[model samples]
Target: MKALIVDDEQPVIVSVKLLVDWKKYGIDTILETTSAADVPALIRTEKPELVISDVQMPGLSGLQLIAMIHEIHPPAQIIMISGYSKYDYMRSALQQKCIDYILKPLDEDQLNAAVGKAIETYRVEASQALIEQSYDFLHSELSKKRAQRLFLLYHTSHQTSVIWAQLCEIMPAFSSMESCRIGILPTGHLPSELFSGARDLSLIVNFIHDLCYETGQSIASEEPIDRNIHILFHSELSNIPELCRRIVDAVREEFHLFLPLGLSPAAPFPVNFSDAVRQAEDAVQTCGLMYTRQPVCFSHVTGKEAETPPVFRMEEQLYTAVLNGHPSGIRIAVRLCLSDLTSGKGLTLRQLLLFRTAYIGLRMRWIESFRMNHKTAASLDAPPGSYFRLPFRDDGQYDLSVMEESLIADLSAISDYLKGVLGMGPASQNLFQQIEQYIHFHYAKHLSLESIAEEFSLSSNYLSRSFKKKTGSGITDYINNVRIQKAKELLENPEIKIFHIAAQVGYSDEKYFSRVFKKTVGMSPLQYRIAHTAILPPLDLM
Candidate 1:
């Protein structure tokens, strides 16, 4: 480690240098510079692990120099030296993460202690960093191998023996294991409420590792693929079904939550890994659709026609009600449709989303037809890929109840938006009236379509359409009308100049105000004032 000492004053620098034993503190070289200006360049070249500087300098104060050095070398430890013993300076030094703040007229013992402390701290941190880096490299290599094993299993052009070689290196028991299988935790299998907002799979992975380690049933390696946890199991002693049952029981015991596990029929290693993965996925899909917590193995399930009887069929009443833009019956229709879909034995998220897309599309069209703000209306338009933006659990499981509730909310919003447009419903009408009243009162102030809409907490497009429908005039026209009416009252005064009258209203330009005056009132300000001014019948002196 290297240490750099910066001070404009020579005596203080020399005194400090003589006091500390740099070699004893593990500092191989001690670089001394009298100029604060040269500190940045030296920091780059020397790359010192420690910087000791005087707080008050000619060009750059110690605080400024420390900041500049930090930009060049963030990990370098800094110690502040100053003539002043003020608390503010000490507080500032602490805030900058300086290792030590030393006072001038320095103590030799204190200086040596601070130097020794900084060196020791760097040594410990460096050692710890090296250890962590090594661990991370190992974990990363293992994770890469796990991913490669899955890829080779699924894409299968590579020789299966190569995969076996890779697996055997990481997992010793896999060398003799005859069969293997992959299982997926399909969406909605685990209740979202259990994990809540956690997005990291580490907790669940750790639990699985602990369970497998304790039982000594099989060597389980977990890889998160497409937001689903796929656990690879290898065994020399235990059967696949027994292993699956142990996993499910362990989860239930730990979380007090039901976890539906699906296992592919164990296939002989290497050659049948791909088929096993597919089988496991299908089994998981079936378990998810049935909403069962038990482990469902493809090999164990026989007579599929008997276990899962088809229960879903489209109902015309719900479809027609949705088409007619009646939300009153949409809720019941949505519930019935969801129930029918979930009733089947094997339903996947993709299938469910595709079926719901048509109904949501119809609702979007219904919403688009209403006079709504462009932003809100655009939100109603579902992105080409997604149905709607809804929250899901950490494990990527969809909460059917939340999904259904969102659909209901969308239906209600569509109904409300339509009603407001057709009948100028009281709630919607009141908003328009409020906007108009705001314009009436603030006509003399600067106003624009966007600004007024913001004032009323509305979008410009929606407010403009609604205002035109209710008042029979556009927003700009209404503002000008209010200003013109006020201008006429001012014109009655006869003392205020036309330019002053224009300024009294919102218009700054007299020419523009006159053009508007003529356009609305059919006369110039001067002409209208003369025409309206009363003339007394010739004062009768006779």
Candidate 2:
């Protein structure tokens, strides 16, 4: 486990550093920083398990950092340390999901207790996950029988009494509910090494049972050989959205997997069970295809079937923006897609995640197309396609704000890569104009390949290759030509020393500058100046 301590005060950081012996609590690395602005990059690089952050700080407040950390690393625990005892600040920290709130004049005992509690929570969760993973090997014949009965109730048309009675016997939670909704959690592609062969189906079925059992929900319908697990819940719970979120979180945290859920609207029990199944099936198919973590609830669809726009329509527009290399176009494309998904009411967070899944495929394909078309791109040795996979992939949820941030970052990288590619081989008129203008303005100073590339937000290697391709000369050669051209104008003035002229042209050492001047002008700096001076009509002797 890793821990990060953040504070603006040096003494405060030092004090907190000594407040706890983190190694005893399973924290091997303790990363401390005084600036909150540095926290985001550190969070990405270190992936700390726990963060102790000050409330008021320069750049980002502790509460703000807490929110960022949660999105980037959902499992990481946070303890907010504030000098103020005001209720509003404490309330804000809690709202941000900080694990513990510590007031000014930190109490060693309170701090110790918080760290201990966090560690224990992590331990208990890990143990429960272990149990869930081991469930397939331990389930008995009775479990299999129960799963079979639920499957029969959902699939076959039967008397309401018969199905209700069987459901009550198998899972008593349904007996008292006036109405129930069924949801199907659809399995994704299983890992070959762990989920392969004859036992894979049984294991997946058992995994669903374990998930429901752990979440306090009852498994309603189960086809032992089928890949989807159907769940039953009382319709009366006003917080169905909360329940859905918990289910999604638990499955991901335990099994490191995501199963799209298709949920039915709450309907009268027994009579509506079959109808609920059909609704869930529709949702399942929709969500499974979209790769959303949220269960689709049929009751939420607002638009008429005729008005519903397909997700692929926006996806196509986004694909064009990526290929065209316009950052604003890509942003608009993603926003439109998200807007379409959310236009309907009762939209679960999981349904929103579908937007991510749908576009990720397009994003990866665009990257692949670029790599395949440009041999120069292949030589750059850019990161692999999998490098673009978001951290949310394993966490089984999407934080829209974080997703937006990720999209911008990815697009920036893609835009930069494309800018490099576009700069090569007959540059677009706009790009060529911009590069020339930039070079003309900043030719002075040590303008290396990397500095210019950084200015243009491109990879240095790619920029160098492309610039040579466009201007028919290398960047270094062009810079030298520009320097010599400037040196020629200065040589016409005898008042300026050769050394001063050399320094004025962005060169530090006159000797080296002289050598370049000779190579370009076919004469030494002094020889060129003297020759030009002789040709000039002798200065008026009046």
TM per candidate comes to: 0.40, 0.32
Runs of candidate 2 with Cα error greater than 4 angstroms are 1-182, 186-228, 232-277, 283-298, 301-398, 419-542
RMSD of each: 29.3, 32.3
The weakest ten consecutive residues by lDDT in model 1 span 303-312
Local lDDT at 144 for model 1:
49
Off by over 4 Å in 1: 1-166, 188-199, 213-225, 253-257, 288-293, 299-327, 339-406, 417-542
Error of 1 at 217 (Å): 7.2
lDDT string for model 2 (1-542, tens) is 88888888888888877888787898888899988778889998888878888888887776778789988877678888887888988888888767789987988889988888777766776688778767854564475456456545545556356655775665565568788888776543222344455335455556556645544345534544554567777776556656666676656565666666677888887677778877886665444223452334444443323133335666545544544456687778656765666566444434444544655666676666556545567777573332233323433443444445566557656665666653432235445435554555445677777877775668988888888898898888888888898889888887677777877888889899988988988998777777777554224310
lDDT per residue as tens, model 1, 1-542 = 78888888888878877898887887788888888778888999999999899888788876787788879987788888888998987898878878899998898889888887777777787789889999998885565447445433633444456665665565556567677767554434333445643433455655665555444334344444444555566634556666667766666566544455667766787677777777876676544333444454453332222222111244343433333344666677667766765654545534554455555555454344342323444544432322332323333334677667766666555544444433324444456644654566467889999997775568999988988998899999999998998899888776667788899999988899999999999998877877776742222210
Query: What C-alpha lDDT do the candidate models reach, one value each?
Result: 0.64, 0.66
Residue 175, candidate 1: C-alpha displacement in angstroms: 1.8
> lDDT (0-100) at residue 106 of candidate 1?
92
Best by lDDT: 2
> Least accurate stretch of 10 residues (summed lDDT) in model 2?
383-392
